[model samples]
Target chain A: MQDLLFYFFAVLTLIFGFLVVVNPFTRSPVTSAMFLVLSIISMSGLFVMLHAFFLAAIQILVYSGAVIVLFLFVIMLMDLKEEARSTFQGIRLTFSLLLAGLFATVLIGVVLTSGLGAEPVVLTLEGSTAVLGERLFNAYIIPFEILSVLLLVGMVGVVLLSKKNLN
Target chain B: MVGLEHYLVVSILLFSIGALGVMLRRNLLVIYMGLEMMLNAANLALVAFSRFNDNINGQILVFFIITVAAAEVAVGLALIVALYRRRRTTDVRELTDLKL
Candidate 1:
């Protein structure tokens, strides 16, 4: 059952991701942005399948919800002139695809040759939100606070950079 | 249950898509989207490892990564907007003022 959902969501994610890359053809940033949001949300579904519910929520909330909205807003604000199309020629693109295939083959080889391997030490982590929260507030507190600081810095930097252009 | 290889293969494919987008696409915004794709591929790998290893720490790190990714998108899009305002184009080849 869960495996079915995983494959379903994974295919959905791959489809939307492909659309996002191709949607630039319409010369519409808004459309591409929307496809990107769908792709992220589908990826979040993959996270949920992995039993990382909190991470899934954060993925959708942060990436699909907040960040993509910001991207759409910027795209709407700008006077995009049907940005120059992708530059890679057919030969180069074919080579890239071939290289990507080669890399995948090598990765599969490594994974297969590494043997089935010992069983992973599966900790008792399910339904343990309390433990997750406690650790977040305790051991991971510094990095957590640093992220907020980083957001602040990013916001201030944006304002300053935009202001420089105006004056 | 889905095995770890399934997750690993999906992530590798997604990461390659991002890399190809970066290498082949000429638009800055599209390239930024590609970067997001790469980050997401990494996030998938992290959560998959967390699941297979049965540890919450990996998921916790994913939370931090999401935070950083949000900030990165904000900053990157803002810069793209600024660049658009100044140059009127998002073409990578043309935005070479500081390329030296």
Candidate 2:
């Protein structure tokens, strides 16, 4: 049962992720963004399968909920027209696809030959929310604080950049 | 039985797809989305390793990564919007002010 779920989510993640990148049926960025949301949701399902339940919830809450919504808002705000179908052509398209395929083949080959044994470790500690919260506030506290500061800077930078007339 | 290798393979494929999107697409927004996908791919790998290793640090790192990604998207989208206001196009090929 678990194996079947894993395969289902993995395939869905790959399919939707591919559509997010290259949907032959639609040239609209909105369509891509929606597909990305589907991809992210399926990925979170993988997270759940891994027993990182907290991360799975956070993935849905932050990624599919907040991040993709932001993407849609920007897409709508720009009112972008459908991209030209001829944008990708000739040598550039071939080169990029070739490069990406080469990258995948090399990485997968390395992974297969690395000889890492596949014995699933009995998880002594599940990534429950309470434990994650404790770790976040305890051992990882400094990085946690730094992340907040980084977010503050990002928010201020975004506001300044988006202003109508920045001198 | 899905093992560590299976998860890693999925991660590799997703990362490659993201890279393909980044290199092949013209729209800056789409490219940005591709970048997000790449980051998520890394996150997926980290989570898998964390699980198989019986470590919590990986999940903690993923939490930080998620926060950083949110910040990145906010700032990145704002920059794209500002650029569109001035340049009126999101196509990457045309925004070549730095081309010498």
Candidate 3:
């Protein structure tokens, strides 16, 4: 039941994540952004299976919803050259791929050796929103307030930076 | 057979794919998306570990991470837009005028 759902979403996550990186058809960022949508949505699914329902909704709302739309808007805003959009053309391609491979090997090896997947412990708590909110508003209240301020600062900074010169 | 390690494997692969995109892709937008992918990979691992460990803190951390990421993208895209306005190109290679 849950195992099958896990595999399904896991496979989808990897496939779309790969496509976001190295899609063979077109090098357009728009296509990559679409694939990113698939990847994020599946990731939220994994979160749900893990019983982090609140975070799962946030993942969908904040990530797949707001973040991806922002990416798409920027893609449409940018004027890209079709001929210049192609990636991995010459020697750098091979070198980059090699490095990427080496990185994957090292991390995957560590994760495999750790045997984390061997122990399938059943969870006692569902990690529901109310529980999360209790902890958040109690112990994590200060940081939560600070985060709001940070978001506000970021909004102001972006507007000022992107605005055309007034003087 | 799915377990914590299985989820970790998927997360790690996701991170690797993102790293490749960042290294190989020329388009700035793709690079940005790759960075986001890497962030997401981290988020996935956090949630998985939190789940298996029977904790909620990891999810809260992921919450902060996503918030920060949204702010980051806003600023980063704004910078990219400003740069594009001045140079009219999104290729990183051509934007190396500061290179001495």
Candidate 4:
């Protein structure tokens, strides 16, 4: 049951994802952006199936709900063109496809060969959350703090980039 | 068998698609969206791994990742806007002024 739904949504998400990447040629960023939002929502459903309930909610709320809206807004504001003369043309396209294929094959091979024969060490739902919280607030505290700094830097950079330089 | 490995394979395919998008697209915004796709692909892998390993750490890391990704998109779009304002184009071809 769960597996069936997972496959269904995964296929849906993949289709929309394909649409998004090919969207530049469609001459409508708005349509691409809408498909992207739908894809994100479908991914959130996958998260729920994984039993990461909190993460699922956050995925929908943050990604599908907020970030996508921002993307749509940006798409609306920008004056998109046909983009016929791009710097990254034929050879680059072929090379990228090749590189992506190589890396994906290698990673997939490694994962498959590893043989996940050992039964998973299941942690209780409540206990798992508690441990996660502890690690975030304690062991990974520095990265947490650094993430905040990163946000600050991004904020400052955006402001500086947007603001008119009074020369 | 449609188990954890199946999910991982699907996730890998998605990541590859994103990689292709980033590699081929000349538009910075499209590249950024490709980057987002890669991130989401990894997030799916993380959650799937967490479920298989019966750990929640992956999910928590995913939480932090999402936060950072949101911030990234925010700033990236802003930079695109600023770049557009100065150059009137978002094509990477026209960005040669700074490269030279």
Which one is best on DockQ? 2
| Candidate 3: tens digits of C-alpha lDDT, residues B1-100 | 6778888888888998999999988778888999999999999999888888888899889889999999999899988888888999888888887899
lDDT of each: 0.78, 0.93, 0.87, 0.80
Q: Sorted on TM-score, highest at the top, how do the candidates line up?
A: 2, 3, 1, 4
TM-score of 1: 0.90
Deviation from native of the Cα of residue A73 in model 1, angstroms: 1.0
Predict model 2's lDDT versus the native.
0.93
Per-residue error for A82 in candidate 4, Å, reads 2.8
Q: In model 2, which regions exceed 4 Å deviation?
A: none
Q: What share of the true interface contacts does each candidate keep?
A: 0.57, 0.84, 0.86, 0.57
True lDDT of residue B52, candidate 1: 79
Residues B1-100, candidate 1, lDDT per residue (tens digit)? 5678788878887887777777666778878887898889988988887777777788888788888888788778878888888788888888777876
lDDT of model 3 at position A38: 92
- Model 3: how far is A163 from its true place, Å? 0.9
- RMSD values for the candidates in order, in angstroms, are 2.4, 1.0, 1.5, 3.1
Interface RMSD of each: 2.2, 1.0, 1.3, 2.8
Best by lDDT: 2
Tens-place lDDT per residue, model 2, A32-57, is 99999999999999999999999999
User: What is every candidate's C-alpha DockQ against the true complex, given to 2 decimals?
Assistant: 0.62, 0.84, 0.81, 0.57
Residue A7, candidate 2: alpha-carbon lDDT: 98
Lowest summed lDDT window (length 10), candidate 3 chain A: A79-88
